[model samples]
Target: MKKILLGTICLMAMAACKNEPEKSTQAVVAGESTKAPGPVEFADQKYIDMGKASLAKFASGDIDGWVSGMANDVVLRWSSGDSIKGKEAIAKYWKDRRMNMVDSIETSKEIWLPLNVHQPQSVESKGIWVLNWHQVHATYKNKQSLTFWVHLDMHYNSEGLIDEFIQYVDRSVINAAVAKKK
Candidate 1:
């Protein structure tokens, strides 16, 4: 009985397939894309060079050189939601911190990526953005040392100067290290 039922099912399936029309197997013709063009991101070596030079300057205590490519009204943002605006103020703040608190800053394993956004999306401006990742070994003036990784993003304006800067780092470790007394 089971074998006869199986034979009947197979015959019914074959009849149904025989009655259906064959489908075309031709490849689809290509056409224009329907999606709107999104942001265009590409690398430019000049931005990478600038980013590296700035970091080198900072590590060597060249505050002015480090900020030379920054716009007069540039803004610096940290991962902690704290921010500092204006070139002179930023320079002053970094200078004071380095001069008073830090003894040395050494960076290694540097990686730089430069991106040019020809078309931007919401809240994003069209410009050149340089991203850098490095390890920082810092020694405080009180003879305390701490090593950490840092990620920096800098956006350049039409003048090829950085107008906005963002840094992603955890300062809590450094804060604790600094708060410890010798």
Candidate 2:
């Protein structure tokens, strides 16, 4: 009788242990263990398609088409310490450059490669960001050529338009190309 009671108690304890939920080893924000972090998500095909379309518009020298993807109050932050605010400002900036300096934009050798995209699941306030590695080849009106690599980050607004555009590049290459004319 005692042996039967002891075995029953041992079986109950084992069953209780098995019913307990397992804990995850993954890290979470604010030490909250209720939710485990998910794997990093890459840009979907839609984002890639949008990026390719925007690049195509740029390559074709369609300033209006390129600007169409941006929000009305878009902010452009360049690595060269230039900040352009508003869609109108961006349009004027590009128009000035196209009219004054650039002779043609070559897209045959240009490449815009999507590197990574991160959308934090825990952070609700943070928006999605995409990293694009670019290789731009352009020819100046003076027949001088410039080719450089640029890193671009784009933040999309809730309306699916690009709200913030940031570029990282070595401007010295462009400056040298311009200085050659002088």
lDDT winner? 1
Model 1 clashing residue pairs (backbone):
none
Q: For candidate 2, lDDT tens digit of each residue in 28-93?
A: 688365644344444455766787788788767788899999999999888888899999999888
Task: List pairs with backbone clashes in candidate 2.
Answer: none
What tens digits encode model 1's per-residue C-alpha lDDT throughout 24-123?
Answer: 6866658545555457756679889889889999999999999998999999999999999999999999999999889899999999988877777666
For TM-score, the strongest prediction is 1
TM-score of 2: 0.69
Query: Which 10 residues in a row give candidate 2 its minimum summed lDDT?
Result: 109-118
lDDT of each: 0.89, 0.74
The lDDT of model 1 is 0.89
Worst 10 residues of 1 by lDDT: 31-40
